[model samples]
Target: DGRCLKDIHCLELAEFRWTLKQAFGSSQPSARYGHTAAVWPPESEIPGRDKDSEFLFVFGGHSAVSELNDFFAFHIESSTWVKVDTGRQTSGPSKRFAHKWDWSGLKT
Candidate 1:
């Protein structure tokens, strides 16, 4: 099939294993490819959550029809996905795919 997928998987560094993630949040990114994703707020704790919990931020990818610039964040601990709004006040990047997100200074 040439369809995109919304499934997620995780790798455990300690155990050197890969596991498929299941039963995640209802809201999620559409099946896409060539998107940029990274563990955001690096080495920081999320408020109201465990110190180990982190968020995965995804941006810009391609679906079957076109490029996407939508943003989303996934809570690792709760298996939840939340769409992020890049407000109108600021002009964000155009829709694209196969792009790089540099976290060094949080530049896209």
Candidate 2:
């Protein structure tokens, strides 16, 4: 349904959610390690809590392949992956390429 972005970064809510499921796939799939290879690569980012609060830096694990279209977010308080959903009407950034994201600590 989609194409792979070589040396690019994708930040999609759907992709992020799907990646979590893929990461926790059944034993059979995990054993093969094919699904894990097709997701996003490891990256580090600083998450801002508020305008005046300290920032939280998080690091993601590496994928098996170089191309990735999935995005995953972690909740520091809960210590879990919180999938963000970019609705169909929302348009901000290209879901591919070596694009980078920064946390501005502002709420929409």
Candidate 3:
């Protein structure tokens, strides 16, 4: 469900199609019925550097419980995924499914 703000419609059908294509490939049904699943709390509100440059990241959701120590950044300009590895074995919050993260900029 998309919320329209101040008479502004926020959902783009074409982008949705593109996203689905990226996730599932070709919009074709999978032979394995449960291969694709929805992520609960479907929104990740990472702040953008500007209108043209932004980072989009996603994590495992309810259907997938694996703790994701690995992440990838999507450079909109290049339209590619850059794998990010946090070499430091720092301990903090455990990786959780259905989690949303906002960019905190670079960590010192």
lDDT of 2 by residue, 13-103 (tens): 6656322222221211111111222212223223432423221222222234443334444332333343444463245343343344444
* lDDT computed for candidate 1: 0.81
Off by over 4 Å in 3: 1-52, 60-65, 90-92, 103-108
**Which pairs in model 2 have colliding backbones?**
8-97, 8-98, 9-97, 13-84, 16-71
> How far out, in Å, is residue 103 in model 2?
4.4
Find the 10 residues in a row with the least total lDDT in model 2. 25-34
* Candidates sorted on TM-score, descending: 1, 3, 2
The clash numbers for all candidates, in the given order, read: 0, 5, 0
Error of 2 at 79 (Å): 0.9
Clashing pairs in 1: none
The candidate maximizing lDDT is 1
Worst 10 residues of 3 by lDDT: 27-36
Q: What TM-score does candidate 1 reach?
A: 0.80
Candidate 3 residue lDDT tens string, 19-53: 32132222222121112122212244334335345
